[model samples]
Target: MPLADAGLTAWSWNPLTDIQVMWSYPFMVNAFRAGAVIAVLSAAVGWFVVLRRQTFAAHTLAVVGFPGASGAVLVGVASGYGYFAFCLAAAVVIAMLPGAGQGHGEESALIGTVQAFLLACGFLFVALYKGFLGGVDALLFGSFLGIGDGQVVLLAVVAVVVLAVLAAVGRPLLFASVDPSVAAARALPVRALSVVFLVLLGAATAEASQITGSLLVFALLVMPPATAQLLSPRAAVSLPLGMLIGLAVTWLGLTAAYYSPYPVGFFVTTFAFAAYVLARAARTAATAFGARGPRPGTGATGGTPHAVEEAAA
Candidate 1:
């Protein structure tokens, strides 16, 4: 059989079989694996991020790690692991900062300063390590096609850990996120939990930044959860739904990028943006329909009958 004929036959087979055939192409397989892992981890952490309004913090950490990782690469180190360590350290330090309160204007300013400094440093390191220019570019823009099995395995572990942590503290996290005042009144260890969650989120962000790059990491981490929240108001349903949507985005984006000329980040971010738009539209439609309800004192049995007699008298 001609190679093209065999390829068509494989494509027409079961989805799993089709995926396996595609995996035979090394870059395609690695890209799909990397995208899937990052999506899961992102959705899991992102739920809390949206709930607590810490999306900016997540973005800052990812950006800060870019330069740190580049510096490590310049010094002949494991850039990926080094970046993860640096991000975690930064998370701890941020958590400990006296005036670095959450969701505040000042906090954003501090994060912006850190991000700018790190990015500048990253550029310097990249210039210093000219021999690894291709690798640095891959780190900055991400190339799903070039991911290796080891990176895939590492992402898988991180995804699993993130899910487990989210599950273990899912309820309290939500409680703390939406109503910290009430949570604190109930003695929920709001401060400590916030710090711990930030650390875990930092780790996940570092892992995700490896594939999506710091610039687009928020698309994977924030968009899905935000979209899910629009689709479902309940936290329980929204969390799982967000994961499902995230997985779909990753898988579909990877497959689409496999055939398209665009980069993986473009496809991933596009998929997320489309999801967000759709979710917003759905929410608006639902609100429009739900608003067509009976007005106060306008229903047949809602008003006082005696008031009519009193007015007549």
Candidate 2:
């Protein structure tokens, strides 16, 4: 049998055509447009998230998004209002919570408490609604099935504003992240930078929730940047490359969800997880192979041995 006829999927055989066909649907266009924007924004904000080691804060901001939408539903307002309001408010509160002299344990306890409180409130809001919260699952797990042009436009606008801020503060933020003490010594406003970045992170988390939902934000916000960082630590290469990977994953997920009977979030999370696993495997393999060979001045009777001897002496 011909390879194309051997039970090959339409996408694998003619990927571009399949994508064009998917794009024919207006809903899919909205999904792709929103997904692409969200993916890039998440990657950009998320890289610093990884650099700053603030995964818990990111997770809390995402969880807070649930209550934001649910409360909006209860109040007869657009869900976007709740998402941004709640997430941004939480970011501010977390930033204001004095970190000075607080032990890691205490800070974690505070963050965890906030998450628990927000989650409890989210459930309460859902339960108190008079009628069934239609598409509640979609709000929780994310859905691109009915994404509208308005949503796409809002996402683009927010992305522009957020990215502009990121560009303006990227260098100082990097310095602060790498060495807070030195940055502070250099009068870099370390605490202020931390707060500003957290606010950006919260915004990114809320934006990502629109696509991946509050429940599984790591699909885009964490995984793509994490995988990219593994591939390269330099921000210049990894940051943009991570955004590319995120866009690819979002497109693939949207395409797969269009054809399958599953939610977009599931496909998106799966793709991101797969990418992370593949990156880990490749890095492991490279390390294993790279370790097998010795350096030019390494192994017995070389610069490496002489250096060791000198250190010992």
- RMSD per candidate (Å) reads 9.2, 7.9
Among all candidates shown, the one with the greatest TM-score: 2
How many residue pairs collide in each prediction?
0, 0
Worst window of 10 by summed lDDT in candidate 1: 300-309
Error of 1 at 91 (Å): 1.2
Supply the global lDDT for candidate 2: 0.80
Candidate 1 stretches with Cα past 4 Å from truth are 1-21, 99-110, 134-136, 293-313
Give candidate 1's whole-model lDDT. Answer: 0.73
Question: Candidate 2, clashing residue pairs?
Answer: none
Candidate 2 lDDT, 1-313, residue by residue in tens = 1212543434546877877777777878998999999999999999998888887778878898999988998998877778888889888987887762122664667666767888889888888986646567777888886578887898899989999999999999999999999999999999999989988988898899988889889999999999887765457767997898899999898788776667889999999999898776655554455454443223221222223233223
| C-alpha RMSD between model 1 and the true structure | 9.2
